[model samples]
Target: MSDPAPVSTIVFDVNETLLDITTLEPLFERLFGDAAMLRAWFAELVLYSQAVTLSGKYTPFGELAGGILRMVGENNSVAITDADISELKSLIVSMPAYVDVKPALDRLRAAGFQLVTLTNSAPSPSPTPLEKAGIAGLFDRHFSVADVEKFKPHPDTYDMVAKAMGVEPSGLCMVACHVWDTIGAQSAGWQGALVTRPNNNALHAPNVPTPDFINSDLAALAGQIIDANTAAGKE
Candidate 1:
């Protein structure tokens, strides 16, 4: 087999890789007060993401978020207003970071890796979930697909991030919990690391490529990146 590519910069996927999405469950339950409805809303959000991509229909991620919220409210017998959706969007901006994310980011920075975030989220009027996570300053830069009017699994989205960081695709490592995101990055010629979380199960999506490395935690993936860089004389 060929040698592993050297990693100069690491780009993280924001939602599940760095942020703890579980926090949203309780918040949503409290806001809507119906467990089943909240779950269905989240499920539909994922479904809509795929549907939009497959249908070649481009919608802002925030709009999709609002749509899911409206569907849930309607299902739960609550009439949601524009104001209610706006408040829910604000809550998303304040979602907490995962426990392991900050330290892992610190370690990567200490090891001389530039860090950044490439997310499918829209550029919004308020602070993003990254700002709420308190690690907003940790990243060298942040990119949203809204800038390109595309979403994850799209090659242009990955290219946008690589171009912004001034790095060739091969020199940047895309770290994400979702296989599709990693596959997209890898196919676009960037190295990818799969940060496995409980809900990510490597679904058998046709034409999706596997990631370069798979680890259960960010710290472990950070170590691998450091080692890879050192081996390639990049450290």
Candidate 2:
């Protein structure tokens, strides 16, 4: 039997995986009078993004997020204004990278892995969140599901990255905090690494493909990926 391909490129999911989304808490608190609404609105944002994709329609992530924010506000009897939606979008694009992200990504780069990002968030003009966080140079490219008009966990989204990068799916490793993202990449024939960020967990279900690596810390996960790929090459 032929040996499986070694993972030469690491594909990261941005947003909550690398960037800290909790930075929006103060805005949420000001708008809804409760910081916890941040999570509720974000959860809805993701859920509906996929729902829209499944329904054969497309809306940019930013637009969808804005609409969901208003929905959440209405559901909770809070009023969300146009300025509030604008502030939310601005905060999202300016979120800081988690402290562990830069160093861990640097480590992966030093190990000679091609690093890239696949996000549902639309590609904005310069000074994107990665640039604002000062880690944009660490990546070779940044991809968005926006290019394919679909939210992630959709097979075509992963395929777009693989095709654009000029590599077979097996040559890529998807690093994401959300199981749905990893599951999508794995289904597309890539290796999957799960970063167990807060509220994210490895799914345990029959016939589900578990991640090849799982860690709460990006640095630890980076090490595992590097070591595994190194050993695989040696064999």
Candidate 3:
């Protein structure tokens, strides 16, 4: 290809992409004796989030997360009580941001790029996760999949961002740690950057399209996006 479209807006994914999911690991460990239970429950949460979308039904993300925690606990023969579920959900809004997230967001902001967040988390009045992460001001707005009754990897979910920004999806760059999220955005004609966080990378499949940019973390990815925008005279 001769050239790629410049990204006028950058949309971030909240969970592990910006906020560190491990912040809630201790709760899982206390309840299940395995901190890895947090990861397992999260996997189920995403799976069910997609499963409901495919079934033409909707479930709020927090509800799905709490339900999945029970499923994961049951799989290990632990009887997860309602109190246990509540305990975990209560910690969600307070999860900490990744150490690199603020610096990355700050760089993008200083370079004249619009930055915002798109999270699968259902909206709540308890203050957005970014607020709890201490990076709320870094984003212009926080969009949730709950608004569209769809989860990520769905084409409509990606379209919502462009519609909200009043720009064609091609003018937006979706920065996410999950390849599936990036793939969905690209399929909807948006630019994409894969954050390639630990245990997270693009799938190596024949039909899987790669993201326009890939880096080990948001800090490096921000640098790459800044360079690309500069080279394209967007800076």
Estimated TM-score for each candidate: 0.85, 0.96, 0.95
Spell out the clash pairs found in candidate 2. none
Ranking by lDDT: 2, 3, 1
> Which one wins on lDDT?
2
Worst window of 10 by summed lDDT in candidate 1: 30-39
Score residue 195 of candidate 2 by CA lDDT.
96
Ranking by TM-score: 2, 3, 1
Which prediction has more favorable TM-score, 1 or 3? 3
User: How badly does each model clash, as a count of residue pairs?
Assistant: 0, 0, 0
Query: Which ranges of candidate 2 are over 4 A from the true structure?
Result: 1-5
After superposing candidate 1 on the true structure, give the runs of residues whose Cα lies further than 4 Å from its correct spot.
Answer: 1-3, 27-40, 72-84, 204-207
Encode model 2's per-residue lDDT on 1-235: one tens digit a residue. Answer: 1233579899999999999999999998898788988889989998999999999999999999999999998998988899998999999999999988988998999999999999999999997889998999999999999899989999999999999999999899999999988888888999999999988999989878889889999999999899888888998
Candidate 1 vs 3: which has more lDDT: 3
Could you give me the TM-score of model 3 versus the true structure? Answer: 0.95
Q: Candidate 1, TM-score vs. the true structure?
A: 0.85
